[model samples]
Target: MKRIAIVLAAMLVTAAVPVGAVTAQQSSAESSAYAGTHVSFDASENAVTNYTVDGETVLQSVSTSSQANAGIGLDIALSAVTDIDASALSLGTTTETSATVQADSGATLNAHDNPKGTLVIAAGDESQYVTANLSGESKAEQVDDSRVVVENDNRTGTFIVVGDGEVTVNEEGNVSADLAEDSRLVFRSYDGERTAEDERSEELIANGSAAAEVYVMQENGSTVADTVTYDEQTTVETTSDAKDNVTMTIDRSVHEGTIVMTTVSEEALAATDNLSVTVDGEAAVEAESYSELQSAANGGDNSAYLVQETSADAESNVYVAVNHFSEREVSMTNDDSSTTDSTTADDETTSSSTNAPGFGIGVSVVALAGAALFARRRA
Candidate 1:
């Protein structure tokens, strides 16, 4: 039964893969190719602890489900030009939410579209993502702990992360995103942009030029082991033994801002210039043990502590942007079991930071581990 719960928990993200209206891409020579308001998007489901609804879609001049969609994890990625008015976004609830949004250049992410008085769209405990367009000479803004962006494509912008999450940016990933308290932000440009022309040699290749940039501002939270972990422990009465722990990775309830930026000049996937802004309240995790650890005596009673260590230590901003993504790969590695798991793990600590100019929309694998052990045996 416990194992069943773990499986369910892993799948709790109901992840509704948004089935976008499919359309083919146009040639670079086509002026209309990859035009206005193109922004990548994603959403998740049902776990909201609180909420609020708004006016009808077109009523507020926005798209409306008019209905309710169950299930949880919703992931929508727009690979082409869009006409979505960000302000027109009608969020059905304003309570506890965990949805996120991402976008590349050529895609208009007009933040001002969703005004409090205009429509009924607001999400709490959620995150946002955007890619800036350097050509349009515009910028994205957000205030969170995790953010990253680059302008190697030749654009300037600002981002703000006022949440408890962390932010990071790469080289050529130009940005003006800033970080706040417990939250962290990073900006580094070491790679060049990936251009569509570069992929001309490949019949199936889309955009070829690659850059890295991420822009984010975070507030706070803890992301740690949400599953089982068997670690070797040093014993005094015995030689050694495996220890179980209650662990999970958590981040500020407010996960806001963009994570990828590309240039529209190359391929639809390579656009930059995303503006975002977010302010989330403090969030915390109640240390819990994974069902798998039941094999240990009194394992259920053990508390947890976050074991964090960075190259720059003591929780400072660390940027890893690259003009040439082909050059670097800065990230976190963990125990074999955790590190080998998935992208969520590789990003034990994450920010809105992203790959520069190319804005490849790299995914972050965050897994914050909260570990704690008591010096007592099962009674």
Candidate 2:
């Protein structure tokens, strides 16, 4: 049986109601930088009643299922501004950048500034879960299996669900999931004209650029998704071994899942000839399309990757997906003969490079463990 734990910070509890009843009490917190954005919580009911951004309501309400064994955990370290008997909610020194609410069952809902201007809501629990209800006229679209896009009156946001559970977006625009232990649900708001392109765009922007990125999906319904920006835990090294040739080697802990490599460089786009990838010292098989590559990766084939040229854009994104992890190397050479072939072919085939790398477009079948990492360029 799955149990739900709700942890609240610094609050006492006394009032008890029947199961599934909306709590009579509520608490609100405001974002300091974004003047009109705020979130309200129903402490007793263990639900977020309202969440607004820039004075516009984006979320109507968010509540856990009735099957949850609700309990509140309070953080006693921070100073509390308001106090109520039998209430399980706390507003501890709420700042413009951060706010937190936890329950005794280890469930937590946190709001913070992710990219300085954007508001991010992160909810996670080893035992509890919650479902979100979109506000008026808002619609939800599933970008992929793990991501959903929410469009409101004039703003857009994304939900990044990381776990072994299934995420569903109903016709009514409601979002729910059956999260496994160590699961996480992250919501980030994009105000004005900043729209979410796809799932990978959010991950890429959040994790930034690194030499290599590893996403590990464990078997226990938990994920270890993070970006390797430097050679701290994962080591990534790039070298030009030969003239007009480049090679990158990534070293990290060996894990039993898929490894994806993405590059958005004009040089890579122009020199898409003689691309080769190897994993665990074995040559990888190139898939004809992104879908085929995804199928091969999920099929447990440890030696599968994709390399293709769709157009002639200034910057093109390329993805290479492989099963398993360890020391892997990717080599690309700008052969003069291949260049001539490309030039002659370009004269015959008038194809423009407008499609970006299909990041998160049914790319990987497993859950992401860590942040998205990009390779550093050699100047």
Candidate 3:
């Protein structure tokens, strides 16, 4: 299911972008920060110590748009980060810790669970690691030339330095994290950061140790966008062996990150535990689709209508459309659209707003465990 969604998203992106063809905008994007930076795994195989002793070094500035110098453990070092982007990453496991990560003065390293035992991240003179399902202390430190490392010698470890942005993790899910704002990142449990030691926090969210968390980090005055429609159909199925509180959280801090769009949901089998799909600590965008996105109906048709726009006053706008239905109807459409002019938190629930708890979409379903497993395989 996760792979399918990824393919679907890629197809949509390809459709939106001409293949092997570059317009002035596309050509400019190549020189833009979020061009195309990939994660590298080779450094994960070259595990070593001295990272803790020397520590990850941060330099002055780096330009991701010019070089697109991306890969795990690129031995990078920089002071100011202008334009950069990433897809997905993770570190180590419970037993054999490792990582695929990046570290910079101003970058978000979104790491996820990597059962492969090692993940290495390097950005702007810093190198780090990521791990999954580990059970011991690992080491992290920076060396000269902005090189850092997480020694997965006796246990698992993950490392990185995240600037202001959002990181996400989900307990039960198959997804292609969507980053639709500048410098914003969407990641799984493997996401982490290496700050200057002033801003620090850590969390591991998932159903079991085998799972991973997701992340979405954004820099100030940045925007990251993905193909996620605010209101869309989604399906989540867990295997028979899946258990415990399955939850996901989008964590944001210090940096003024913003989330301006989102409108997809699956009412059946949504995220267990509390779910925060977006966390913007600073600025933000409007919900790109229907605020009240209704994607699934009675396990039948999965469809949603979306409208995108911004208010005139530069204020945020939330376009709401609920999914009300009559079972007798064959072809259906949204009966109404509820628009909220000014939303208040006290009179309502906490939103996926400015690092608040993630707003929930869809619903949670609890059935027999065996059946759930079957559903996952089918999904």
The lDDT for every candidate, in the order shown, is 0.19, 0.44, 0.23
lDDT of 1: 0.19
What's the CA RMSD for each of the models? 26.4, 22.1, 24.4
Query: How much does candidate 2 score in TM-score?
Result: 0.39
Q: What is the lDDT for 140 in model 3? A: 38
Highest TM-score scorer: 2
Model 2, position 154: C-alpha lDDT score: 68
lDDT, candidate 3, at 348 = 20
The segments of candidate 3 whose C-alpha lies over 4 angstroms from its true place after superposition are 1-251, 255-257, 260-379
Q: Against the hidden true structure, what lDDT does model 3 obtain?
A: 0.23
Ranking the candidates on lDDT from highest down gives 2, 3, 1
Q: Sort the candidates on TM-score, descending order.
A: 2, 3, 1
Point out the worst 10-residue segment of candidate 3 by lDDT: 203-212
Over 8-70, each residue of candidate 3 has an lDDT whose tens digit, in order, gives 555445444432354556544432121011222211212211222112211111112112333
Cα RMSD, model 2: 22.1
